[model samples]
Target: MTISIAHLGPPGTYAEQAAVFYANWLVKKTGIEGILCPYPSIAQSLQAVASGQTQLAVVPVENSIEGSVTMTMDTLWQLDSLRIQLALVMPIAHTLISCATSLDKIKTVYSHPQALAQCQQWLEMFLPTVQLIPTNSTTEPLQHLENDITVGAIASSRAAQLYNLPILANGINDYPENCTRFWVVSEGEVEANYRMSSISPSHTSLAFSTPANVPGALLKPLQVFAQLGINLSRIESRPTKRSLGEYLFFVDLETDRSSVQMKSALADLSIHTEILKIFGAYNVLPISKDLI
Candidate 1:
């Protein structure tokens, strides 16, 4: 059966790039055929999988330059059926695509908010007067470039080539090492066909809510991991949305969920949290520069 993968699109977005990489990797590793399905928003892409419209969804969870993707985190928390199957770290290179003859001719810039923020410093230095507009995806504004010389879009070089647009500037991101981590998520248990060779130092993600916002309420759950010597790679808090002070804490642990230490840690952790969710344990794949 051919697996269907969902991602943010009209095509040429970073999320789609990660999805394509994972789709190719799936074929190489397990001989599973996959097809790409594009959604207009990250939340909709994830919801596609949750609603059984697709088998898997690749969504951005974090960025090295801009930090965690709140949309992915919030949606993942709300959808209990979804589980992360793998993590892909892809380097991001922002390109200014336009029909303008020179930078001075550009008056408006368009891109996803994250892309715009990542290129903030460079834009201020070069295109300071251009109006910065945020779109649904990096590729959304590519179509408008040809109609107006004053309009430019911040997207990938691949996107420029895909749209057949002229690139006015390359490597426009504020940081040279900017990258985003995406998660291949699916509904229900992880299929055996999706498994790959063991990649060491696996990560397990989870979320939990405290009974109340009392002091020591959050610390009690954290201390469980500390006492067990299980190091946490990330910990972030999102509002539960039901109340102002109530929150849900998301964490990334450096051990596999099936490991003995992690099993024990969760058992102890549950005592302190009102509700707990285990996202999944998965390996991280770094896309080589040559591949990007």
Candidate 2:
């Protein structure tokens, strides 16, 4: 049987590349065939797995240059049944693509908002007076290209090649260390055998909320982890959307979710928090020169 995997795509998306990489890895490790199912948005891609439309979904969680993808994190919190199975880091190199062979002929720049932000310095230096338009995805700009040499796009080299557009400038991103972190989410809880094989450390993601605004209500659970010597890699608060002053704390622990200390800490933490949702335990695939 073929496994269906969903991702944000229309063909040349970074999410698509990541999904294909994961599918190849899945086949290599387990001898199982996997297929791609492209979704219009990150939330929909993840929803495909939650709604059983696909076996798994790959979506970006964070970028080295742009920080966390808020929509992805919010979707994960809303879709509690989905758990992170594996994580992959892909190098990002944005190129200026267009029908124009020369940068001087370009009049407008188009790309995803995040891409625009990442290449702000480079764009300001080269195409300072051109109009910048934001599209849904990096690959979306390719569809709007016309015969006009005035229009340009900031997308991946794969997108440029796929669309048959000329890459006028290569590696236009402000930072050479740009990379994105993607998570492979699937239905049900995380399984031990599905974890990624990487030299980097493991992480357990979870979300919790307090019962009331009582003193030290939030601190108690954090104290539990600290007292147990569990180091937290990330901790961010998002609005609960139920009421004012109500928020959800998302935490990433640098340890296995199945560890003895983690279980003990969770048991104790439950006493202080109203809700504790454990997303998953997974390993991070570090960025390597070959991964690009």
Question: Estimated TM-score per prediction?
Answer: 0.97, 0.93
Error of 2 at 261 (Å): 1.3
- List model 1 lDDT by residue over 1-292, tens digit each: 5899999999999999988888888998888888999999999999999999999999999999999999999999889889888889999999999999999998899999999999999999998888999999999988877889889999999999999999999999999999999999999886656655465438999999998778899999999999888898899999989988888999999898988899999999889999999998888889987886
Error of 2 at 201 (Å): 8.2
Q: Write the per-residue lDDT of candidate 2 for residues 1-292, one digit (tens) a residue.
A: 5789999988799999888888877787777788999999999999999999998999998889998888888998889998988889899999999888788888899989999999999999999999999988999879778577899999999888888888889999999999998998899964344456453337888999998888888899899999999999888888899988998999989988888889899899889899889988888765464654
Position 171, candidate 1: lDDT: 94
> Model 1, which residues run further than 4 Å from truth?
197-201
Each candidate structure's count of clashing pairs: 0, 0
Candidate 1 yields a Cα-based lDDT of 0.91
